[model samples]
Target: MKEDMYSIKMRAVRKEKHISGAERIISEKEIEVLVQQLTARALGHSKGKPDFINITIQNIGNQAIEYIAPLNIATITVDDYFKGRECAIKALQKSGLSCKTSQAILNMLKTCNTMRGAILLDIHSLERLEPDENRGVRVTNIDWSFKIKEDLEKALEKKGLNNNHVKEAVALASKVSNAPGIVAELCWSDDPDYTAGYVASKDVGYMRITKLKPLGDSTGGRVFCFDSSKTSIEECIEYLQKKVTLIHKIPMIKD
Candidate 1:
């Protein structure tokens, strides 16, 4: 008999305001412990305790294993990672963003002391798209149930690429870049053990940069860089908050 698989989504809310959310794919045996851990982490957030927490568990069956496989790629050198970071910084600069602003975004992700969700930044005006009372937008209840194109999957398989995390990131960045005014995206994991991050754009796809933060540094967040001239702030926030973004295709990889 095969073991069961589940997708657990937890959202922290305070006074009807979205605080933070976490999603994970786990085996049946790990469900209870994982939920407890996530719950504690959310409620114990440095920012204040949430008034309520919503946890959703979906039985995605064993087939979901392919979507949550461990990243087992070989290690990369520090030099290579720095080179990739410089290249990504240059690419963002070429996309109408100032080098200082781009580096600032990267640094923010590298040391995201405040446990918040994604931040929306205007590329031209350099203003944050935040609510009147809120500091940033929380992208919650994300749908990650889309299927990949068979040919694209085959292409990735041919390249020996089996990392689902990378695939999901690229797909999400692609969807975000398609939104009106969105120019690029910067993201890194909040997990203390994960140091890899990526800079993505509609024109350049995904560019992976390693060593975004020092090992054991638990700070991380995402920034969506956009142009205010092309879209209203309300529309931009709505697209990310309410839109059911699907991963139809994985954008090309840019080294």
Candidate 2:
């Protein structure tokens, strides 16, 4: 009876089903193209040939070498045993190449296990380093790290808020059985550490949100709850469709 209810439900269901995949291996020709592009960018030259290609590369063992042509040096080496996609990216960046170029080069390097003369390249790009008059290549990148734990907590709290909102929307939709409407955040609490999902109302109590998954073993979704037990799904849905109002729609974080 509710217009667009099925569509919204389907979309919500779809977002719950997703997964990460393994990285793809690189190819030699693609590597050559990347090298050519990087060389042109770095040295301002166009030296790509039918038979061979030349570009500067840093080996995992920390050796910097130049391959004349036809060489297929892998992006990873014995020194860096774990050949992940991220590692390939680092290797490319260290060689003063852009992410796209690095990816292309990494694909080529995937062919060879180790090659002689290629040096250990630091992951920092030349452009990312600080300026130095004496240095031929200026170091520009600064090493900085964030408190991942704190960030993670904040993220989790936000997720909670989102989950709460999702539950609220669903409950409202179900209770009122009204035309499909969006349940959106109106506001959040004062605490910086709090998330949008955990906030409670004096009347509603703690809202619960149950994240749904697809048919298979896909990831994402969690169960959440609101305080009010009397609040039926249809009621919540009807309320959202007509009134669509709430206090502290966003989550709050306490210091």
Candidate 3:
């Protein structure tokens, strides 16, 4: 018998704030098990118990399948999830960014008190790449079925690392960094439970920053720093807006 595929998206909320989220594509037969697993994982998050859990299961065509209830569940601690603020500053300095640029990036992060898409910033000027009154660049409707994702997964697997979030972030960062004039990328999740974020560049691959935000804080976003001298703003923004971006391979940084 042929099997049907489904998309499962889960979000955990506490006091009306988004605390955590997980997404997966699986066969119909595996839906129940996957949902149960994600639900348990969200409840056990170290950020604290969620007041509500929202889950939506859908088919490949975007048709909804089911919506789950507001269930609360347990917590797990991440290794080095809270490396003092100084560590982040030092990490940016070591990445070859100027103190001014580093401080600007931190300031941008502070403004991400709510969920907004990734923001593109000019490294030299410290201005938003595409200015807007309320929102940043929205990275949506990505074609995740691309071969690049599979290749990255295999490469990451070879390294004995299999975190889906890391794989996705690396894939996106690699694409952004490879664009002409683009210098580096920094990202942390808005999900309060997930404290780890990364800084990536073409010269040095993905460097995981153990703690970019405090636990229970949902403010987080991505910043792609670019040099205006190398690439036109229009050109750089066009490249980032493309849905199918391909990179040969990501060079992973080691301790």
Candidate 4:
């Protein structure tokens, strides 16, 4: 229904689900394959390994890191700490992430016109003084920020769709009966600070998306995260079908 949710530049990052029986501790010569998140089938991330496998980490503290990879952390010895940081940096550069600042990323948005995906500035990214510290901003990435608080407001003013459009979408999501807490956003993708995700199950046993963002082809956004599982599969499918149909029909002001 609704053409199987029209593809957008945002594709949800999917993780099948994985729980380490024990913390994966690292040794001198060995390193851990750090992902945005680990799933039962963490290999799913292999598709975009360059981006997700952040800095090829090490479990310095013998604890499981989830969702977001720790870019830098402090240790007992300054020498050891700085060495680890240096290693991660070298690996980051080697991994092919060249756009090292929000400004560079902004330039990508302004010049490219056709974006693979957008990057949002995170705290880790904000530490850079001018260029060097400004890493982590990358294209073709579903920025976990999904930050559109201001952009969405402007769009609403621009008649991207009236208040009724968002109200209707939120209403539809909430009325699902099976899950009343369901929330929805009228996501706009073209903005550099934007990202949107798909509906997927979390390891917490709830069918909710966590640290997942999807990227696709359209600057125009779409209704992501359908097929709820808190209810019966048949009902979930039908609900998604109906939700997509209604939202797709809603008019979006084309830029």
State the displacement of the C-alpha of residue 101, model 4, in Å, after optimal TM-score superposition: 25
lDDT of predicted model 2: 0.24
* Candidate 3 lDDT tens digits, 91-179: 56676788878778877876685444577888887888776625666442222333345665675577555575665565566566656
Q: Which residue segments of model 1 deviate by more than 4 Å?
A: 1-8, 11-53, 57-84, 132-135, 140-145, 149-164, 250-255
Worst ten in a row by lDDT for model 4: 69-78
What candidate 4 gets wrong by more than 4 Å, as runs, is 1-165, 176-186, 189-217, 220-229, 242-255
Q: What's the lDDT of the predicted structure labeled candidate 1?
A: 0.63
Candidate 4 lDDT tens digits, 131-245? 2212211211111112333454465466433332233223232223222211221122332232321111111111111112224322322222222323333443334322222
Per-model TM-score on C-alpha atoms: 0.64, 0.17, 0.62, 0.19
Model 2, span 1-255: residue lDDT tens: 311110011000112221111111122333455454433333321111213223333222212211111111111122222333354345334434467644543333333211111111122221211122121121111101111323433544554432323333222222222212211111111112222221112222233212111122111111112113234434433333233221112222222
> Residue 106 in candidate 3 has what lDDT?
72
What TM-score does candidate 1 reach? 0.64
Q: Candidate 4: RMSD over Cα atoms?
A: 22.5
What's the lDDT of the predicted structure labeled candidate 4? Answer: 0.25
What tens-digit string does per-residue lDDT give for candidate 1 at 1-111? 776657688878777755556765556777898799779878876446899999899876655222211112222234554665676677677666789988876665665
Clash list (residue pairs), candidate 3:
43-74, 44-74, 44-75
Whole-model Cα lDDT of every candidate shown, in order: 0.63, 0.24, 0.63, 0.25
Q: Which stretches of candidate 2 lie over 4 Å from their true place?
A: 1-218, 222-232, 246-252
